[model samples]
Target: MTCSPPAAPGPPEPPEDAAVTTETVTEPVSTPRERRGWYFYDWAASAYNTTVTTVFLGPYLTSIAEKAAGCAEEGQTCADLHPLGIPVAPGSFFAYALSLSVFAQVLVLPIVGAYADRSWHKKRLLAWLTAFGAGTTLAMLFVTGDRYLLGGALLVVSNILFGAAETVYYSYLPQISDPDERDAVSSRGWAIGYLGGGLLLLFNVIAVLAGDSLGWSTAEIARWSIVSAGAWWAVFAVYAIRPLRDRPPVETSRSRSVFYAFNQLGRTLRELGSLRLTLFFLIAYLVYNDGIQTVITLSATYATEELKLEQTALVPTILMIQFLAFGGALLLGAVARRIGAWKAVLASLVLWAVVLVAAYFVPARAPLQFVALGAAIGLVLGGSQALSRSLFSQLIPAGKEAEYYGIYQISDRGTSWLGPLLFGLAYQLTDSYRISIVSLIVFFVVGFFLLLAVPMRRAILAAGNEPPRLL
Candidate 1:
C-alpha cells in the first residue's frame, strides 16, 4: 500500500506569483530512505531497552546494590533485597531504587514531552537525551563493590533520560509518516527494533560470560556491558539523524513567546475534554502498560531470588524472549490487520492476565517457571506495546500529531508508576512473589474494559482531519 503525504498546509501559499513564474513544485511523499531512517531510530534505541532496561543492567545493578548495602559479599551469593530497609533486610535497596526511578519518570516525562513538542529541534533533543542516558548507563562501570548510592544515581539518570528520549521519539513518529502507511511503518519499525535489540543483547551477554570466565571481576564485566550499550546507541542513532528531514517550526507572532507556549499547552489541555476517546484510551494504556513494565523490570529478580535461577539460565531465558519478541511483533501486526488493532490489543491483555495467573501457579522449579513466563511474555509484550502505539496514533489530531503524541507520552509515563508500586507493595505486604504477580492482573482487566469503550474509526478520522494548534 502507498500513502500520499498530507495536504500541504493552507493551499501552498496561493502559488506565490501567478504570472510568468510558473515553476511547478511538488511536495515529496515520505521516501523509502526517510522511512528507513526513521525506523533505524527504533533499532538504535532498542539496544537500551533489551540490554540495559530488560535483560542485563537491572540484574547487574541489583548486584551492585546488594554489595553496597553489605547484604552480600565478594564472590558470595545473597538473597534479594527487601521491599524497604524496614529494620535490616537484604533487598531494601532494590525496592528503593525501583521506586525512585518510577517516581522520577512520572514527574519528569510529561514536562519534558511538552517542551520537546513546543521546541523545533526534536531530533537534536532526542540525540542529547539519548547521549545523556548512554553516558549514565556507562557510569555504572564505576559502581563496583557496594557503591549503592553511585549505582542508584546512575540508574536514576538512565531511567529519566530513557523516558525523556522515548517521549521525543514517539512524538516524532507521525511527523514523518503519511496517515495511510503509519500502521505498517510502525509495525515494521517495531519488528526491526526487536531483532536489533536481541542481536545486541546476545553480543553483550557473550562479552559478560567471556569476561567472567577469564577471571575478570564482575565489576569489570559489568563495566564492559555498560560501555557496549552506549556504543550501540551512538552508532545506530546516526541513521536517524542523517536521512531525516525536519519540519519547520510553526511561526508565532511577537506576542507569542516561551510563556505563550504554556498558554497554548493550557488551551490544548482544555480542548482535551472533547477528545474523550483519546483520553479514555490514554487512561486505559496507563493502567495496563504499567503492569507490563513492572513485570519486565522485576522478572529477573524474581527468577534469581525466588526460583534460584543462576545467571546462566536467566540471561539465556531473557535472550530467548528478545528473539521471540521479534517474531511476536510481526505476527501481532498481522493479527491486528485481521481482528483490528483494538481487539488485538484486548487479546494480548487477556493473554497477559492468564499468563500472570499461570505464573502464580508455576512450581518453584526455575526452568519450568522461566519457560512459562518467557513464552507468555514473548507473545504479548511486543503486540501490546506496538498496537498501543498504532492505536494512539489513530486517535491523535492530524497536523498536531507531535503535540497530541506528547500528551500521549505523558499518559504512558504517568501510568507507568502504579504497577511497579503495586508489585513492590504486594511483595512487602504479603512477602509472596506469587501474590505480587497475581495483583498485576487488575491493571490488565481495567485497561481492557476502558479500551473496549474507544471508537477506533472516530479516532482515525479525528487524527486525519483535525487542524493544527499551537500546542
Candidate 2:
C-alpha cells in the first residue's frame, strides 16, 4: 500500500460532472493504513465469493434442488423443480438466483451510491449491508431437506446486499489514492483478497477432509463450511469499518431527497452517453466481465456436473486456484507495468477463451485434466478483474468517480445476468453442460473487438487526465 495522506477532511459534495468537458480535479493522496483497511474489506468479503458462492454452494445447492426435484443429483436428466409454475433446474437454480440478484442490484445500487456520495453515512451503510448480507449467508445453515426456495431466497438476498455494499465501498477508491498509485494499490488488494480467500478455503478443505474421519457426513461439513463463510465475512469487515470514517454527508439541494437522487441518476445517464470511449469501455467490460464472472461462478457446478469430479478433488483444486491467483495478480501487474493494463487484459481474455474451449473437450472423469484447466483459469482471473478496475479508475472524470462507478457496477451486474442466463438457458434447452460452457467464448470474442475500438488517448483526454500510465 502507498504511504500518502488522506484527502483533506471536508463536507460531502455534489458530483461535478459538467466539468468533464473542461479540466480534471486532482485527488489527494491516501495513507497506507487506509488503503490496507480498504483492501481488508475485499479480503473479508471474498470468503463468501470464494467458499460459498464458488466452491461449495453450487454443488451443495444443486444437490438440495435436485433432491427436492426427486433426483439423486443434478445431471443431464435431473428433474426440473418448478415453483410458481416456472421450471427451475438444479443446474440453473444458482444461475437464476445470481441473475435475480443482478436485477435487484441494477435498480438499487445507483440510488444507494448517489445517496452515499451526498451523505455522511457511507461507512455506516457499508457496514449495515455487509452485516445483512453476511447474516443471510449464515441463514444458509438452515436450508435443510427440500427447502430450496428458502435457501435460494437467502442467497439472492445476500447477493443483492453484497452488490449494494460494494457500490458504496468502491466509491472510496478515488477518495483514497491518486490515479498513478491506483494500479498497484488495486492489484495488491486483489492479491490480498486471493490470499484471504485461499486461506479460508484451505481450512474448509481440511474440514471436509476430516468430516468422514470425525463421523460427520459430507453434507454436514458443507453446511458448516457455508456458515463459516458468513462468520468470516462479518468478522473481517470490522477492520475497514473501524478506522475509516465517511466524509460528512453533503445534503446539497439536489441530494436532500430521494426524488433528487433519481433526477441526478437520470442526468448522469444522459451525460454518460455523450462520453463515447467510456461508454464503449463499459459495454466491452460488461460483455467480457460477463464471461469472466460466469466461469468463476459456474466452474464448480460444471466440474461437479460435467466432469464428475468429487468434492475432495474439487476443493483442493479451488484452493490451488485461490493461491495461484494471488501470484497471478501480482505477476500481471508487473507485466502491465512493462506493457500496459489494457493489453495485459486482452492477453488474459485470450486465455479465458482457451480455457472455455478446453472445458468443452476435457475428459469428464479426469481429475488432473480439471486441475490443469483450473490452473489456467487461476492465472488470468485475478489479473483480468484487478486490471479492469484500475484501468476504469483512470478514465473516470474527477468529482464523479462514485457516480460513474455506480454505473460501472450496474453494467458489471447487468451483463452478469446475460452470461449466466445464457448458460442456464443452454442447459435447460439441451441438457448439455459442454454446450453451455463453450457458449461463453462469444462474450470474450465480442468484448475483445469492442474494446479494440476504444481510443484510450481520447478517453483520457476527454476525462481531462493524462493518458493512463498503467495502460
Candidate 3:
C-alpha cells in the first residue's frame, strides 16, 4: 500500500454539494490507512467473482442438475428438469440462477444503499452482508449429489448478497478519497482485486489439474475450490474492515424508517433529471458495460466451441488475463493522471471495439491467435471498469453518494441482459459464433457517441461537485 503522512487534523470545508442535501456536512478526510482498508475489501470480495462465479459454479451446477434430470453421467446431455411444470434446461440452470440474483439485486440494493446512507452503521452493514454472503458461498460444500434445487437457491442468495454488499462497499469510494485521488485510488483497488483473485484462481487451477493424481474426482475438486473461495473471502475481510472507520451518518432523521429511505430513493431518481449529464453518463455506461460483460462472459465458450481450444489452453489464458489485468489497471490509472479519466475510458472503449472485431476474425483451431486476443482483452478490462467507477463517483452529489450509486449499481446490474440477448439472436440467425461476437459492437458504438455528448466538467459542477484535478 502507498504510504503518506497522516491527514491534517480537522474537517475540510464542505463543497457546493452541501446545498443539495438536508444533512449536516461533515467533510471527509482521506487517509492512507482507510484507503488501504478499502483496497483490501476489493481484494476480499473478488474471490467470489473469480473462483465461484466465473470458473466453477456454472458447470458444476449444470452437472448436478443434469443428474437430477436422470442423466447417467455428468458430461452427457440430459433431459430438462421440470420444476413447477415448467421445463428448465440443465445447461441454462446457472444462467437462470444468475439472472434471478441480478433481478433480486435490482429490487433490493437501492433500499440497501438508501438505508446505508441514512444509518450511522455503514461499516457494520457491510460486515454483516459480507459474512452472510460468504456463509452462503461456503454452503456450496453441502450441495453434493443431485441436490440441484439447494444449489440453485444458495447461488441466487449468495449472489444477491454479494451485489448488495458491493453497493455499500462502493459508497465508500467518494467518502474515503478526494476528487483528485479517486482515479488512482480506484485503480489501485481494482489492481489489488485482480491480484488477490488471480492468486486464488491459480491455486485452484493447480489443484484441478493435479486432482486425478491426488485421487480426487472432478466434483471433489470443484466443491473444494468453491469452499476455498468462501474461506478466503471471510478470512481476508477481517483485515479489510478493521482499519476502516465509519463516517457521520448522512442524516440522523429517518434512521428507523424503510419507507423514508424508499421515498428518498424516489427523490434521488427524480433528481437525476436535473443532473442531466450524470444521467447521460449512466445511460452510456449501461450500454457499453453490457458489451464488456457479454464479451467476458462468452469468451470461454467462444474459444472452446468456435476455435476448439481445449481446457489446457483455455485455463491458462484465463490465468494470464487475470495477472496481466493487474498491471493493466495500474497502467490505465497512470494514463488517467496524465490525460484524464474521461479520455482514458474512451480510449479503452476503442480498444474494446477493436478486440471484438479481432475476435470475429480469429481462425478456427488457432490457440495462439486466441491467446493473443485474450492478452489484448486483459489489458483493457479492469482499467476500463475501474476508471468508469472513479469517473461516476465524481459526477454524483456528495451527501447523496449512496443514493446516486444505488442507481448506478442498478444500471450496472440491470442492463447487461441486452448484449447477451443480441448475441444469442445473432448466433441463431447466422449459425456462427463469430457473427454473434461481432454483433456486440453496436453497444460500444452507441455508448461512445452518447458519452461524447456528455460535458464532464459541467456535469461534475452541476452535481455540486468540483471536477477532479485531471479532468
Leading candidate by TM-score: 2
Residue range with the least summed lDDT across 10 consecutive positions in model 2 = 1-10
Query: Which runs of model 3 end up more than 4 angstroms from their true locations?
Result: 1-28, 69-78, 304-308, 363-365, 411-415, 420-436
Tens-place lDDT digits, model 2, residues 358-470:
99998888999889988998899899888888888777766566667777776452226788899999999998999999999999999998888888778878876667565
Q: Tens digits of per-residue lDDT for model 1 on 182-225?
A: 55667788888877888887886776577666887655665676
Q: Ten consecutive residues with minimal summed lDDT in candidate 3?
A: 1-10
- Expressed as tens digits, the lDDT of each residue in 405-427 for candidate 3 is 76677535222556656765565
For model 1, give the 10-residue run with minimal summed lDDT. Answer: 18-27
Off by over 4 Å in 1: 1-28, 73-92, 217-219, 250-263, 410-415, 462-471
- Measured by TM-score, how close is model 3 to the native structure? 0.88
lDDT of each: 0.68, 0.80, 0.79
